[model samples]
Target: MPIESPSRRHVLQASLTVASSALFARAGAQGLTGPAYEVSPWPGPLTAFSLVDTSGKTWRPADFKGRAVLLNFWASWCEPCRAEMPTLQQMADLYGPEQLLVLAINFKEAPARALQFAKRTGITLPVLLDVDGQAARRWGVKVFPTTLAIDRHGQPRLRVQGEMDWTGKAAEKLIASLL
Candidate 1:
């Protein structure tokens, strides 16, 4: 008998787990200490990509130059992503428009689903639709709640795996350090 290949969701989950573990290990080695969020700095410049929001607005890295960015990749079915929505909203309210830019990238989901989820959760932050998961793939996102902090220069400074308390001091400290 032949073994069946894992489903895409299963494969994604496994790869995300391994990648997250590696990110944590590297963070530990770098003497990073804080909350459960892992911080892995990008070695070089950020890759360019574009995705449209539900409003048919396209956003790219260049669009947010000179401002810090909180780039979150999520899906409507993800519990952690759902749970973190409020905190993300808080972050947006606290440091937005002029200070920080918060973008929630909906992965491999329809615009309607994402829009409904955002509406139900009252998440007013910009929700960019990654309809085909291509943008997520390019960003090396294998998990539901992967978040990256991009500095003013449009470079990724840290990648946080798993859920995070965006309204908390640790997160504030991390973002403040970038700004």
Candidate 2:
């Protein structure tokens, strides 16, 4: 039986707008933006560790500065990891070293096994060796094929667990947004 005041209506509208924006931002950060990723908002310093590739060159998270890094922890025995290798390789080629660096870190596996898997899969991406499981422990990797998307500043941003279609449109859009 009474009309609402102008100030009250303005406040309600503003509150609704803010709420909607927050919801969308949270959803986008969580890889729910129509992408095949399972993103989680991980805004923190990356776990520190040092690992080498087949060439014996040491690598750290900080070494990937100035470019987004896709640090994937996987094992040769993981079927999902093997299944995702080609798509990962394709993504690596698409982004290249200047934009996105895809690091396929073999989890506690022998160099021979890692090399053999890469060879078999024709994976051209740079493969890092998580020898002795030190790096895996530091990164808190409990599952196979865990992919962490790190920003250019060496900060962990998004984490995608399980396998994914990295070559799909949703993935491309998400990576492009990061770039």
Candidate 3:
């Protein structure tokens, strides 16, 4: 019998499982009956990013300085991501781009596939391509459908892991705080 080291993939998977379980447990303990938005006040400025959307427009955090930004990291294969997308679009419509900008960052997916999903779902939100997943990695997005809410001054306010109804009361409250 030989002692073998765990592979990198196994280690990463185990880490993610533990993290997700802990997050859910914390949410339950907090009596979070509404949407689970983990209040994460960033100690510093917003994370720097430069990504291109499906329409080939380069976007950066500074580009949307005066408006609250919702950065959603999603993939076409994620069912929850697919389900929550429409609500995100609705939120964008409700607030308008001047007040709130919702950018859908596709995780490690092809631009064509993401564009197809947007077209099929009739989503009008700008779909940014994270082809190398660097943006997600930079933002520390380990879970699928993680959304970070940034305030008008380009500061991160809260992070929500998993799917959430953007039209719900809790979501409205969160959005209100950002705006």
Candidate 4:
């Protein structure tokens, strides 16, 4: 093992700090870093739609009003979807039913399977089964773990296409902004 001298360590730390700052600054300057929502007013109340949580409680889309809601399209077949669940749980821990809503829409998965998966994995977020893929079509979801951040007015604010580091400082701040 090579030990870095005090001067070398200082230089390395300074370099790392500068690099991190530059990335953030560049992202800000580009102005295309955040998410963009293609739909507005969330279309309509999440009626005609049915979702069951681990406890068998049904959640209508309308139930998520007055708060920022996340429409997540996921499947047990997707590796990323399962891998990113912990981050989703962390977000759930941070935001309550009043501030933010995390709705996990499971695609083509049977209710029993969804419930079983949730129980085994400890995914507390309400998992709605999209048995017919109709709900996924409404959201234009082409991939697993696609997330839509909808404002209180039902307008979609951001659309993320993959697993995200939701508990990161920037993500937390962004959600806070919505709140």
Model 3 spans with C-alpha error above 4 angstroms: 1-45
lDDT of 1 by residue, 6-78 (tens): 7866998999999999999999887576554566775535777878998899898779978998889999788
Candidate that beats the other on lDDT, 3 or 4, i.e. the better one: 3
Task: Single out the weakest 10-residue window by summed lDDT for candidate 1.
Answer: 35-44
lDDT of 2 by residue, 47-138 (tens): 67778897688888768879998889999888888888899889989878888999999998899889888888888777899879877777
Clashing pairs in 4: 42-154
> Cα lDDT of model 3 overall?
0.88
Q: What lDDT does each candidate get?
A: 0.83, 0.82, 0.88, 0.75
Candidate 1, residue 48: the lDDT equals 75
- Please give the distance, in angstroms, between residue 133's alpha carbon in candidate 4 and its true position after superposition: 0.7
| Model 1 TM-score on a 0 to 1 scale | 0.78
- What TM-score should be assigned to candidate 4? 0.69
Q: What is the C-alpha RMSD of each candidate to the true structure, in Å?
A: 11.6, 11.1, 10.7, 8.4
How well is each residue in 1-179 modelled by candidate 4, as lDDT tens digits? Answer: 99999999999999999999999999877754654212223343343566666567887757867998887888888887888777888897788868888888888888888888788998888888778898888767786778777777666676667677777775686576566
In what order do the candidates fall by TM-score, top score first?
3, 1, 2, 4
Between candidates 2 and 3, the lDDT winner: 3
**Model 1 regions lying over 4 Å from their true place:** 1-36
